[model samples]
Target: MLKKVAIGVDIGGTLTKLGIVDREGNLYAHMDFSTTMHKGFGDYLDELKNQIEGLRSQIDFEHEVMGIGVGAPNANYYRGTIEHAANLLWKGIVPFTDELKTRYDLPIYITNDANAAAIGEMIYGNAADMKDFMVITLGTGLGSGIVSNGQLIYGYDSQAGELGHVKIVDNGRLTGLGIRGGLEAYVSSTGIKRTVFYLLSDMMDDSVLRDYSYNELHGEIITKAAEDGDPIAKAAFEMTGKILGEQLANFTAFSHPEAFFLLGGLAKAGKWIFDPTRKHLEENLLPFYKGKVKLLPSGMMKKNAAVLGAAALVWNHLQE
Candidate 1:
C-alpha cells in the first residue's frame, strides 16, 4: 500500500517551516527557510514552491502525496487569503490559495495558525478524544482557537475566538494592535516582560533583572531569573497568571470547554506560570464550574507541532 501524507506549511514572520506528515501526525521530512528573505509575495511563492519540491524529493516514490495545508497569521479559511497580517511582508489581502493553485494542481487549505493548532490537537494531540477544547498560544503575543461541539468556531467573517483581544482591564497596557486592556497585553511573553518592569518599579527588591535593558530581556531570560529566585521575575509570573486565570474563568462562562491547553513560549515557564494560573483559575471559577475543567500542556510539544497542525488541517478538511 502507498503511504499517505500531506504537506504542511507554517509561515511565521521570520521563518517558514514545511514538512510532510502522515495521518498519525508523524513527521517524515521537514525543512525551513527565512520568510523575510523575499521582499515580494511572488518571489516568496517561487521560493516556497522550490522548497516544497525539494522536500517531496526526500520521500520515497511509493508514498502518495495528499493536498497542501498552510497555517499563517491572519489567514482566512473561507476566502483562502491572508488579510493584513501585521508581520508579513505581503500587505493587504493576498490570494494565498489561489496563488498556490496556479502553481500546483492539488487541493489546498489555509487558516490562522491558532485554528490550525486547535485542529491539530483534535486530530493528533491530547485533545484527540476531546470534542470541545480551547488552545491558548502564549508566544510574543497570545492567540487562541476555540472548539465547541467538535467544531472550530469561525464567526461570520471567518474571524472568531479571539480570546486574546478580550478586554481584561480598563486602560491597561497597550498592544501592538494599538488596543488597551487586551488580555494578550497582560498574559503573553511581552506581557510578562512588561509586568517585570512594573514590579521592578513598585518593589525595591535587589534582582539580576535590573541589569538588563528592555531589549535584552526575553521569555527565557525571565524564566531563568525566576528559577534562580529573582523576586521581580517571580512577581511578574504571578501577575500574568492572575490576569490570565481571571479571564479564563470569564471565558469558561461563554463556551465551557472541557479543557484549555497552554502552548508556546511563556507556557514553557512550567511551575512559575502553571501553578499560579491553575490556582487563580480554580479560585475565580464559579462553584458550578470548579474542578470540572482540566488545564493541560499540548501533546504536540515534542514534534514539529506547527507543521503537524497545518497538515492536520488538510486531513480534517478532506474528511469534511
Candidate 2:
C-alpha cells in the first residue's frame, strides 16, 4: 500500500521552504526556492507548481499525497487567502489556496506562519499533551499562536491572537505597524538590534557593539558579545527578556496557557534570553498564576519547524 503524506510549504519574505512529511512528523524530502524571483503572483504560482511536480517525481516508493498545507505571512485561514502581506511580493488579497487548487485537485490549507507554528507545536512539539499554550516566533518581527482548549484560536475574523502587537510600553519604540510600545518592538530579533543601538546612544559604557555599523549588526553578534561579557550587549538581552517576560505574564492572564514555547532565532540565544524572561515572567504573573506557566524552547529546533507546522495544519484539518 502506498503511504500517505502531506506537502508542507512555509512561505517567508525571502525564501519559501517545502517538505514532504509523513504521519510521524518525519520530513522525507525538502527543498527551498527564492520567493523574490517572480515579478507577479501568477509566475510564482507556476514556479511553485513546477517545483511540487518535480518533488513528486523524485519519490521512489509508492506514496499518496494527501494534501498541501501552506504557512505564509498575513494568511487568513477561513478565507483561504493571503491578505495584505507586507513582506511578500504579492499584494492585496491573493487567493493562495484557490490558486493552488487550479493546478492540483488536492485539499490546501492556509494560515499565518505563527498559527502554523502553534499547530506544529501541538502535533510535534512539547505541547502535544498540553491543552493550552502559546508559540512565539522571534524573527524579524514577533509572531504568536495561541492554542486554547486544544484548538488554535482563530477568533471571529480568523486573525486573532496577535500577541506581538500587544502594547507593552507607553510611547515606546515605533513598530512597522506604526504602533509604539508593541511587544514586537522589544522582543523580536529586530527588536534586540534596535535595543542595542538604543543602548549605545543612551549609555556611556560601550563595548564590542561599537565596532559594527547599524546595518552590519545582528542578534548573533550581540549574543556573542553577551557571552564574552560585554555590558551593553548583556544589558540589551536583559532588557529584551524583561519586556518579553512581562508581556508573557499579561498573555497568561488572557488565555491561562500551560506554557509559552519560544521559537525562531532569538530564542536560540539560550540562557542570555531565557533566563531573564523567565525571571520577569514569574515576577509579573498574578499570584494565582505564578510558578504555574512554563517557558520552553521548541522541540522542532533541530528540524524545519515551519514545514512541520504547515503539514500539521492538514493533519489537524483531517481530524476535524
The per-prediction CA RMSD against the true structure, in angstroms, equals 1.2, 1.2
Q: What is the C-alpha lDDT of each candidate?
A: 0.90, 0.91
What's the TM for model 1? 0.97
Candidate 2 accuracy as TM-score? 0.97
Q: What are the per-residue Cα lDDT tens digits for candidate 1 across 21-132?
A: 9999989899999999989898899999999989989887568778999999999999999999999989999999999999989889999888988999998998988988
Write model 2 residue lDDT over 221-240, tens digit each, in one string.
99999999999999999999
Q: What are the TM-scores, per candidate, against the unseen true structure?
A: 0.97, 0.97
